[model samples]
Target: MEEKSFLDRMLGHLRETCKYYTGYPKYLGPSRVIHFTSEREFVQLLHQGYPVVVAFTIRGNYTKHLDRVLEEAAAEFYPHVKVLRVECPKYPGFCITRQRKEYPFIEIFHSPEQAANQGRVADPNITKYSVKVLPFNYDQSAYGFREFFKRHGIRSSPDPK
Candidate 1:
């Protein structure tokens, strides 16, 4: 028997710590897609050093495919980015407050790492447009999502040495 490395162990723990849905195969990625529970959870992701993408969705005709593509992309960029799906029905106010009225609205929030390097938190009292809201016509394909991430300073993979 061999001992699992710490990184492997931690990823294993986080993989099982998140959401699971039927009718979908297990994602073969380093990071897992999680559910957005609350503002506290959002803050926790920031505090935990993981950049988070929250998808506000409903049972619209386009949502299932949209979610599938989003999850696939997240898997492609695993460990570096975490994706959280939010069912707006459960928390309409959550989406409404952020002005995400359209279904499958995607919002990206900065990690503490980016916040620190960018001098974004000079004053926590003042709010900023730190969140990136994807257009309602946002693409739901892995390639499209990859492009979106790239344009917004998120990497689809880790840097080379």
Candidate 2:
């Protein structure tokens, strides 16, 4: 009985360690979409100099649909545009300030240099970061996102590092 109990505890610990390393289990996949985990992660992503597409969404079919679109876009625009999604319900405190009246609010954040060249102003809400945030109000499709990225000068191919 003692050995069985010890084994169970070991298994439980292993499970938790896997969860920590893999991130939210539901999001584990080949998809390039980076699940928003912390403000620190967000800041790091912004500083990487790639255009980031952030989607603030609640749990719903529409959010799932948007996730699929973003996954496709991220796959196509790898190394050029990074895609992230913050589930509002999961992180209410983090999303509270960025939330909109509607669900699945989308925003594209441009790097500081890119924003400056385009004459875009930095978002006051994100004072610490110099990224320019533009509300995405176009069609919610992979093609739409690709076109939007193209329009904003995000190259379809990865920039030569």
Candidate 3:
């Protein structure tokens, strides 16, 4: 069997999320939209010690894959890894604080894996993430995302890595 590349591995998780998403409305909270109201709420996501894929949306450019990513993470990893989609309009201050220069991408919190798949060379000072802010990408494939989470120490699947 051929070994999967990081992107393939990550995309696999999103593909598999469909199974769990069909029932999303039944058990999860509020209408499909997810939000982070405060810095504390945002920190709460990262504090879980798991990787959180936080998407920043603006001007109606919806990030479609993130929902699948969230569903997949919830289905496969449950409390281990998660995705939070925040609308930039409602959270104007949040965006300003992060100094966001781009829109419609995923912002990860509490992750130290260098975003190897997302393309920023691994930050040399892993500890700096606690105080300094880092830029993130939202362009990787779903398979790549799963590997990103696992590589960062957030285990999601029952399958052996």
Best TM-score among the predictions, by candidate number? 2
Q: Is candidate 1 or candidate 2 better by lDDT?
A: 2
Candidate 2 residue-wise lDDT, 1-161, digit = tens: 34568887886667655523233333334889899999889888888888888899888887777877787677667777899999888888877876477888899987654233434448645433366788898887667787777687766665588
lDDT of each: 0.68, 0.75, 0.58
Candidate 1: worst 10 consecutive residues by lDDT? Answer: 127-136
User: What is the C-alpha lDDT profile of model 3 across 20-81, one tens digit per residue?
Assistant: 33333323333333466787776656655666667777654245655655554454445555
Give the range of the ten consecutive residues with the poorest summed lDDT in model 2.
19-28
* Model 1 C-alpha lDDT per residue in residues 1-161, reported as the tens digit of each score: 99999998986766655454434365465546787778767766766555667778888878878767776767766778778888888977778887745567777765453333445567777443244444424466666667777787765577888
- Report the Cα lDDT for residue 37, model 2: 91
Worst 10 residues of 3 by lDDT: 126-135
Q: Native-vs-model 2 lDDT? A: 0.75
Residue 142 of model 2 has an lDDT of 65
Instruction: Give the local distance difference test score of model 3.
Output: 0.58
Stretches off by above 4 angstroms in model 2 are 1-29, 113-127, 159-161
Give the TM-score comparing model 2 with the true structure, all chains together: 0.67
lDDT, residue 125, model 1? 77
- TM-score per model over all chains: 0.64, 0.67, 0.53
Model 1 CA deviation exceeding 4 Å by range: 1-31, 111-138
